[model samples]
Target: MFFHQDASFEQLSIHRVGNKAQDEFYVLSEQPVPFADDEVLPGLLMQYFMSPFAKVNEVYRFMHPNEDLELNEVYHFTKKFFDGKMDFHSLSEQLAKHLYEVSSHPKIKGGELYVVHLKNVQMEGDSQEAIGIFKSENKETYLKVYPEQGGFQLDYEPEAININKLDKGCIIIKNEEEEGYQVLVVDQTNKSQEAIYWKDEFLKIKIRNDEFNQTGNYLKVVKNFVNEKLEESFEMEKADKIDLLNRSMNYFKEKETFDQEEFEEEVLGNPQAISLFKDYKSNFEDDFDAKFEASFDIADKAVKKMESAYKTVLKLDKNFHIYIHGKREYLEKGYDEEKGRNYYKLYFENES
Candidate 1:
């Protein structure tokens, strides 16, 4: 899931559909859906609204055309509409009706969709669009996300702070099988396009509870930990830190999985530094209340995502990227006796 808190939702408007910009639709369960904990729904619901693209409500089936598509196939399958068999208005109506039916669905009881106008809905200078959201209820799931990033913002969201912006949003609480009350669960959140396929093709992808997703909140903690340790121990120059992060990201690109030993050897070659990293990692997990995998593997598509956050550039009015690919022998950082000045030198094809 995107976050860890099992929080509650307010401003419940049952079957309350807002305008296209702010529509809240819910499908309630006729039966109570039982859950072990309530730590799931907040993250799940928030992640849903975090999507960049608006998911077409439901899968459409063509009648009269006799074109056979699976039921509950929700996506931008507008080709059929282009064929003159169904028009856009018809398609919209069809999906809307299907959502309404789902709002009052009987077989699975009830489910909900919240079209939220995300107040302060920002990703801090990220070009995150084409987002997909998926949720599962009673074995049914679909990708749900808002399909647009109108503008980007660069503010960090605070924790333990209550953000009540439901004036332009909604949430779906599915009461399945409980027959009374049900606890909700926050399942997953991803910012990497590497995992976009899961949202696009198989809307009902089952998440493995065992293997941790590298793109989850834990990875963010790990990144922070890495940054802090590097800053504290190496006291690295900003350029050096960025270079290390870029190199680490390159390692993830070259090798999908991350082994601590390998990371230490490749990214932080100094023995004592690696030891410091170990301590930082230990404290990080404890302090952040997050964990990492034995071998953290990221989808290759996510490599591009790491590029922005892990870029290594020295700004001198323009920009210069310092790419360090092994061979510390080619680099120099020391004071020159003759010049009595601090200096840093890098050797590469451009210089050679």
Candidate 2:
């Protein structure tokens, strides 16, 4: 069973594939049997066939409320009119006959299924041509070619109007294939393609009207982008913390490379006076320069602490040379695109 459009007439389309179209129809119903709490075969078959028919009847009535149907009478009769322990073929023949009689009335032809019996049809004098028998799975039976076959498969059908916009109420079917085609209705018209926009003239609208205001879909997309970036930033921050501590240690070690006595005396004047400095220098010389080495070590640790903090905030690597010889410098940022360990030069330096 498929939902398709007909421009010329109002009709339902049902196609049976291969030998067991009857068998296949019943089996399709078997899937829904558990819901009805019926025995697998008979109960399943009854529910399967009737449910879609009922829905179609309801839709037909809604579309044509003025028309009276013998649908209810047929439904009641068919429910109890089953043959004893009917099989798929038997039930199908019975249902087909019953429907034909009930819908034979002119006014209620809407629900009628016209069976075109073209058994063993062939050209008048062409026995050797032999186009009559259609091959079924197990056996080859005479073909039933109806005049309606020309109309059954359309060669060039008119294209449906394109709607340029899609609203929130619009149904979206992803990866919809050709044979199992699914269409959406953004407005009153059917949307069969991907490019149709609801705002377009194909929707047969003059002024653009929002169908359930689908602008929320775009807003959701923006929200997702922000959330993803936030997550990435959080991860980068974690990686940066380790970088900071490493840089802090490197900074102080670089600072220690400078002469401590000169840094203290010349850079920072000894106000407690030159006598204290002289005594300190003498104490350092006595113990094989222990005081000088210890002072450098302490300076190195302090500089390392500051450098670590910067590295954390800036996301710099440990191998990246950051020097503070009166000025900050960046030696590397880690791997290059090609060579893997290329260094980068500083972009700028302050004149001050």
Candidate 3:
């Protein structure tokens, strides 16, 4: 998990980035924003920038297709700033300019870009300094109510930023500079073409092949194989599919490490099914550009996160929803010729 409980802002620089496609321009601040005197603003700004990253587990690194890390613009500037070769204000300005160049997307909205130098961010067991890059593209109107002359007064603030909603954010940890740093990012508006520019075009980052990623990706491969590929090669009922999913989840939950051969033999007992699953897993790895090790420690967090997706509900013709947890042998599927309908025979001792 990522935490910033003891984190404090070291430097903050705000710049106005405009939509370049609309012929708008950007404005850079002359100096960093000072918050030493104000006590409350710092906490609010910190929440705005850091709160969204509290539960981010997946990590990414700056990557280039040709294996040249220096080619990544964000990585270059951040590395220089971390090495003390460049000042915070200068680095923020350069980053703002780079963002403006990529803001050419027509759907990209102009907003205030905030560059923050944060200290004492804790991730897992290690504490490290991190750089926070945030942008506020959307604004809201808030009504202010105050007492005036013993009477209630109301005023409207036309341009107000809601601290709770952060539009886009990226946290670049100082650790692992040689491996492109441990970067955690958030893009709340990542539903459109414009959102792609923030992480893909601007950051140029790729998923780090850590334990968390390995576990999550492998689980996804198994799920996809069960749901999609399994049907192509075999005739199976929805209940049977759910049983396979339940078995897969149970294997991950009970075991500390994953062994491909052992998993195939136990969870997928059929030799033909195991062979098909291996081919599908290989294609999945190739499509995602990820390699799943033959054996690795299973990440509990990844398993828990993926548990919700591996639901065991079997929906039957919008009428009955059977939740099959385990014991596929106990649940039998058959046809009732007399009633001219299909039915299920569930053998359960307890009604409750």
Ranking by TM-score: 3, 1, 2
Q: Return the top candidate by TM-score.
A: 3
Q: What TM value does model 2 have?
A: 0.14
State every prediction's TM-score relative to the real structure.
0.39, 0.14, 0.97
Error of 2 at 7 (Å): 30
CA lDDT, every prediction?
Answer: 0.40, 0.27, 0.92
| Residue 72 in model 3: lDDT | 90
* Residue range with the least summed lDDT across 10 consecutive positions in model 3: 283-292
Expressed as tens digits, the lDDT of each residue in 214-307 for candidate 1 is 4443334446656676666556765566566666666776875667777779877889877776777677667643455657665554455445
Residue 326 lDDT in candidate 3: 94
- Give the TM-score comparing model 1 with the true structure, all chains together: 0.39
Best candidate, lDDT: 3
- Write the residue-wise lDDT of candidate 3 on 137-244 in tens digits: 999999999999989999999879999999999999999999999999999999987789999888999889988999998889889899989999899999888999
Q: Report the C-alpha lDDT of model 2 over 193-237, residue by residue, as the tens digit.
A: 322322221111121111111121112222232233333434433
Look at candidate 3 and tell me the lDDT of residue 227: 92
